[model samples]
Target: MTKLAINGGTPVRDTYLPYGQQWIEDDDIEEVVKALKSDYLTTGPKIKEFEEKFGKYVGVKYAVAISNGTAALHGASFAAGIKEGDEVITTPITFAASANCILYQGGKPVFADIDSSTYNIDPKDIEEKISSKTKAIVPVDFTGQPVNIDEINAIAKKYNLIVIEDGAHSLGAEYKGKRIGSLVDMTTFSFHPVKHITTGEGGMITTNNKELYEKLKLFRTHGITRDKEILYNKNESSWYYEQLELGYNYRITDIQCALGISQLNKIDKFLRRRREIAEKYNEYLKDIDGIVLPYQEEYIKSSWHLYVIQLELEKFKVGRREIFEALQAENIGVNVHYIPVYYHPYYQKLGYKKGLCPNAEKLYERIITIPLYPKMTDKDVKDVVEALDKVLKYYKR
Candidate 1:
């Protein structure tokens, strides 16, 4: 049998560190246990507490917790009044949900090129893509760096476009010193195990718009209105309710909310540790030839969700696949942040072709996400750096 490249036995430094993962603590479990023992489990007080605390933490007036990130996107899109035949502009260098939410609401997704350095949707390209059918712009905060929201907002004002920021990787990120949630019409965040915080599987949609908040609240449940004022008859008992609009069963359980509350308490620590890891990577890899480290705009503070490094293809003897395989051989777990959304088969069938977003396609050729999570220790960081050094040296022209 061929020996595995990275020694899988004899405590060989466990080489499968992934690009991102949850950092659960004992306290997180304790909180969940407390909730499990409490009176309510699904639609309980803990869920409301989580929503209020999370909304306040992000400086938003309203937050609606949902089943998962995809549901959050769907809720935001629906609340934004995205109707059939409408067009939503967004970048291709993101998870498909960023675009699929548009399709879910019977809206078309228009691909826009991304900024080469930040890997964010380019505001200029977004402006260029606008047409009569365009109703909104969903700018993804890719890899935890907030997009140029000010510029995007300015463009939106010019075109009367609603802004829905896909903030899956940017729960703790800031733009121009302001929290990301408050800067757009609607912002969606994920709580997957790999994200900065985890509530098993959960998501939140934040916005300051009262109408949007009410709409999202109704949409999160089964479109049933429990607000007594919205009822036509005051004599009706608690059993009486109204289905104001078609909605979904995206309500989050109290058990998850309990965990989220616990996780939120440690978010600052999580963000700090992630930044430390990212800074260390930047310091160690800055001098390596042909490697393009992530760039943070002066006005933005990233949550450092993933430390992605781009390779200069012309300077290397081997391609991205070769380097990735070599790292895996060395027991270093690596990943790509995304494949351009348009490259997916479903989108291709929808008339999205390869050349639509050249910059994003170019980014796809060289981007590699290295391991960077809050749980990673100093030695782990050193190990990752050493592995990269070895791989790059081995593949150098």
Candidate 2:
């Protein structure tokens, strides 16, 4: 057998491959340049154009652009009327921002366990977490896979709670013959560099309810509105506007919107390439011992923002950290998707104890994020698989 890289043997590749990255084309740069030369940079025509196009893409009536994905979540929480004592249910196995948005509105973020197979928030756990204080459900499309939306929606309807789909990882993903944004009360997307699409740093919230749309817009722009009909001082001058409520300055720039528009134009092609890469990974990693491949449902189409794998620790002599380091030694840029949100020190200080989400905590111990982007070559995919096989086999008990 070939020697392991962790033992100072030959590595898989010379260059480091990141777990994720953005793909920028020439047209994307041209659009940004045009926006820079235009009259406005923050509140320009490009913002509206991007919003309209994004809304149409998701089959939603309205879309509000924000400074970042976290801002989008904050806007959604504000629009949902989250208050001091209200509780918003979300999964623990996600970025802190997913749950932090609830705290921003002075609401409590209730942690729900994830389904081991899909790494998504379990609908049954969501229902169990609901209480008299529950006001909204923020189910994340973890690893670009759509959560059980139909069941979550039914639960929300039964309890009269709002549904804010955290779709930061699933821009082009589909669910039950329809896109994700259209299926929830409010669905938020990210345009960070590593997301499915990039606007440098931006976010969007899509909704069918005009009321929610208006609230989202208000929250995005410091709770200010200049619309004649909604203005409290209708008889005031044309320049007059009102601050209806306290809000944040979460507006995204027009330059970024221009980039977003350009990126949006190629989302389909990018999504198709991502699916192809995922298929290749699935085929190569399926029979490998000491690993658990990601699971996908037949009915949904995943955008695959991340390609995460779970190490079968029992089959290996060393722990997860050792295997992770071994893969890195092989020049494979591997990273962990998350450590449960509640596991953070801040959450612990706020009285959130460990063991709240057993499945998420357990999964966190074995999960590692592998490279998955549109720009990756087939050789890059193969190298990643071979590196995993080598490390896992080397550490096999």
lDDT of each: 0.91, 0.93
Q: What's the residue-level lDDT of 339 in candidate 1? A: 97
Write down the TM-score of every candidate.
Answer: 0.96, 0.99
lDDT of 2 by residue, 1-397 (tens): 7787888899999999888899998999999999999999888789999999999999989999999999999999999999999999999989999999999999999999999899999999999999999999999999899999889999999999999999999998999889878888999999999999999999999999999998998998889999998988799998889999898899899999999999999999899989999999999999899788899988898989999999889888999999899889999999998989988999999999998999999999999999999999999999999998888878899
TM-score of 2: 0.99
lDDT at residue 384 of model 2 (Cα atoms):
96
lDDT of 1 by residue, 1-397 (tens): 2233543422224657776778888999999999999999999999899999999999999999999999999999999999998999999999999999999999999999999989999999999999999999999999999999989999999989999999999988999888878899999999999998999999999999999999999998889886997766667888888888899999999999999999999999999999999999999998888899999899999998888999998989989998887787776788997899999999889888899999999999999999999999999898888778877876689
RMSD of 1: 2.4
- Candidate 2 residue pairs in backbone clash: none
Each model's RMSD to truth, in Å?
2.4, 0.9
